[model samples]
Target: MRGLLLKLLFSLMLCLFILGTVLTAFVWYVFNYSDDRPRSSSHPIRKNPEADPSGVCKECRENTIDKMVEIHSHTWKKQEANFKKFRSQLTSRCHGATKAIVTQVNTPLESKIVYDGEKRKPLVVTPKLFSTFLKEQPFKNVTWETCAVVGNGGILLNSSCGEEIDSAHFVFRCNLPPLDKGYEKDVGNNTDLVTANPSILLEKFEGLMEHRRPFVESLSSYRDSMLLLPAFSYGHNTPVSLRALYTLQDFNSPVQPIFLNPEYLQSLARFWRAQGLRAMRLSTGLIVASLALELCTNVHIYGFWPFAQHPHDRRPLTNHYYDNRQSKKTVHAMPAEFAHLLRLHGQGVLRVHLGQCASGPR
Candidate 1:
């Protein structure tokens, strides 16, 4: 009877030991390898985008927006921005609008236009070239209540933000993005100003040296919007920018081509550098966003995401909304630039739109 009781006790002890070992292994796996960790009240668990492939999970969206209230905010709330203070800072630091565009008044008949990118090279203004300059700055006497600076990131793929974007008093776009072929519903038709990189002329239009008619037709989509060109930014850009102006004028298209002041661009670069942004050059998005903050009372930014995967869905995204082409990683420090915008969004200086827009207009 004693041997029998001892055997039963030993068996029970072995079973308990086995169960405890199994439980310890599971706990170790979960804490060390698996995605389970103790959470502090200050740092909540971040939602994994991989788990929500459909991106329609409303709970994740709400939690993302509610918890961080920065980059992943699915909802946009208009905060009472200290417009005067912010505008004052921009003006004092960069003088953004003072010489925003190169005009006949700013560039003299024989003035040397220093290249912003290649500071050593400068373009001398000739009489014929001087004629293309706008008589004065654009929107000088007008006031814009709100402005939209639209980027071309694929985050805007299905975002129905077109109506809300068009409702802004002024709309600015980067890199002369296509606004047609079923894209107008998402990107909007209004463009008060659009920047045209010199590369576009070289790549898309073949330097405008031949087949100029195609270039003329492309301008039809912008419909009288000012073509902001960095004509003096590089030495090679001058000829092509001049050609674009001549093409528009020859065709008698309402679209106007204007040069961006290199000096203003340099100052703008310094302004951002002062804020600790160290990139080869500021991406066109950041430059335009800074300009919008100074030019308008309220600024709203769209499609500024720089990640390869969707913030909420983890699906692959094209570099741009219109194409799957990737950007040159070495050219721009995009992620770092986006971080600056995120800070601005947090401070209520600007509104960065993420996720899809509401069904109805704002």
Candidate 2:
């Protein structure tokens, strides 16, 4: 009888436990069922886009206005002093650069990739197995007087700055941008040196893995300009860049293919970092402009603006003059860089040409 009583109590306990578990699970399901079930909307909700950090923001606009007012109100003597200071800062390291650039293949051959922030290794050029036609920097003998470093920014569209751009003794273009179509009037036909981003190799030429004829044919507009590639910037870019050289040679293209000295890039990065730009890497246009400051007696930059809207008016413009490729917020602090460039322009250290160049010889 006592055993039967104990078993009855045990059965009652088990029933109670099962009931409690069921109740707890039901409560949990009631709370979380909506999370699992999808909510289908009849009408889609449109969200407003966030502001671009790469472009001029509200604060930048206000600051630019303040600087303009300050410049307009200031005396010529003060501006001259500022310009002198700016010139000193830019040319402090890069004037008549020799060791900074790789003049010989042996300089970097068998050398580890020490340039830039990344620590990469074992990158070498074996002449016995790997042959390169590119021997040295192409324009080592030339000294440019008036140099123009053109940005591919959409601000150059309809600006008619081509004549002004061509007037420069030397011109630097970024990313092997198209010079044909209707862009010649704004971006100019002259090209001294154009830097091709490694990304361009992958995207446009399929990393030059096959059918390099398209790549060679694309250089028709550039015609005898030097093709500068950041081949050693990263170890992966080396093969594609070397292939580009071979392609040019096989077709005997007039465009002289040259690779950028990683050391030159590293020094350029350090220069910008000292100027308060904490970026992963400096933009190609900015690097070209920095080189221009050292190489050219007078520098005139066109299409360097990095704002979505016109600084004077609030009208939006295309991100690039060539294609409507939407730009994302980048590691490069473009607005701050532009502001620094504007300040330099204010002091007459360089000329920043924006929108609609006046016709005739610039």
Candidate 3:
């Protein structure tokens, strides 16, 4: 009787050990390997939508539908009001009438006479009309290609990166100057897309008209290119004016103006007004702009960090990019938010190489 009881106890211990091992293996598989498989109706496991569109299951679909309803009903209205308030602040602070004059004087022309007509002014080409024409123009079938988003960081200077930047099937920049002198030697002359945000343009080129002329000259170098524009808002008036001026000048380049959905802006406005949500909102515009360029396979970012770590101490400072002239000691400090951006870099969604490259000063 004693021997039989001992044998039964040993068997029970073995069974428990086996069960624990199996449970450990199941947990590991669920956390790590489950995301690797193809999702289908027949399969019980669901896949990530960003990795595989077909991985969505019935439950996930229902959850998405519910979330969409919540965003539209509860979130959108709140965002719209916040955006209006921000607009009001910009108008009141900047002096509405003066800003209007600046917009008018700098606005791009509607059309220009490219050819002379016998009686009426010859048919003109304007950025507004040019974009319309491009839409009507059908594109020939072509294989997908990679694109590089080059920032105007001094870091590219003397880096011998012109070849690399130009090697991409398509390249994008912001406000290319006409004369190819300073950092242009390494940055290259082949540009397929030029981003023209109204606020950025106004802030960068408001008084520097001579510097603006080269951008037009540079456009002449590329056979196919686009002047990217954003939809109008009080915060974006300056960039819009610069785009309008470029159009008025008859740069003869294709123009693509992206009108972001009002819903997206409303979300952004709410996010920005929130005490701790502004940094997330700040990068949302870049993400939105990147989405518009569906033609590009990969989009690399440069010179985007409003504040970058100083080389000596590795602390965030405002004195990196020439364009960011605002005092370093602003009312808002974004350390926590910048850390979130670094997390995004680790996720491989964007390549944020602000001061890492040794070509030039940031």
Find the candidate with the highest lDDT and give its number.
1
What would the TM-scores of all predictions be? 0.78, 0.76, 0.43
The residue ranges of model 2 lying beyond 4 angstroms of the native Cα positions read 1-96, 99-101, 105-109, 115-117, 128-134, 139-141, 359-362
- TM-score winner, 2 or 3: 2
Once fitted onto the true fold, the runs of candidate 3 whose alpha carbons sit more than 4 angstroms away are: 1-145, 153-160, 175-179, 200-223, 235-277, 280-285, 288-296, 305-324, 327-341, 354-362
Candidate 2 clashes: the total is 0
Estimate, for each residue in 1-362, the C-alpha lDDT of model 1 and write its tens digit: 99999999999999999999999999988788754555677986666564666675656545543443435464545556555666687888776666889888878899988899897877788898888888888756556888999999998888788887888989999998988888877888899899999898999999999899998888788898889999888888888998999898899989988888899899988888888888998888988899998888788889998876677666777889999888787788887798788777777778778768764333
Which is superior by lDDT, 1 or 3? 1
Query: Weakest 10 consecutive residues, lDDT, candidate 2?
Result: 69-78
By TM-score, the best candidate is 1
In angstroms, give how far residue 67 of model 1 lies from its true place: 9.7
